[model samples]
Target: CSSCKESLEDQCSSINNEDNSTINNLKEKLSLISNFQEINLEKSLTLAAEVGTALLQENDELRQQLHLTKFEKSFSELELEDQLEESSKKIEKLINEAN
Candidate 1:
């Protein structure tokens, strides 16, 4: 009976030790997952900021191009008006000479 009791106690101890090891491994895995999540969050924030900056720069460039196009259009209109006025004066002069 004593020998049987000792064998049971030894078996119980072995099982308890294995349970403790499994719990420790699970805790380590949880810690690693938590660390990875934090890193991913930081990377996501950084990427968002970079994309925002790029979008702002693109917006500014588009606005500048729009302003330049408007200025060119205004200049072209003025040039056409000048040419029309000169042609009209020439036609009037020719009519007067004909008279």
Candidate 2:
């Protein structure tokens, strides 16, 4: 009977050790998961900031291009008006000479 008690006690102790080992492994896995989540969150935030900055730069470039286009159009209109005035003066001079 004493031997049987000893055998049973040994079995219980072995089971307890296995449970402890499993618990330790689970704790390690949980810690690794927590660390990975933190890293991912940080990277996501950094990427978002970069994307936002790029968008603002693009917007500024587009605004500058628009301003330049408007200036070019206005310059072209002024050139056309000057050409028309010169042509009118030439026509008046030709009429006076013919008369």
Alpha-carbon RMSD of each model: 34.1, 34.2
**Candidate 1 local lDDT, 1-99, one digit each (tens):** 346446555655665565556556656655665576466676567655655665565566556556655765676688799999999999999999999
TM-score of 2: 0.57
* lDDT, candidate 2, at 63: 64
User: lDDT per residue, candidate 2, 1-99, as tens digits?
Assistant: 346446555655665565556556656655665676466676567655655665565566556556655765676688799999999999999999999
Model 2 weakest lDDT span, ten residues long: 1-10
For each candidate, give its TM-score against the true structure.
Answer: 0.59, 0.57
Off by over 4 Å in 2: 1-39
Error of 1 at 11 (Å): 84
lDDT of 1 at 62: 55
Number of the top TM-score candidate: 1
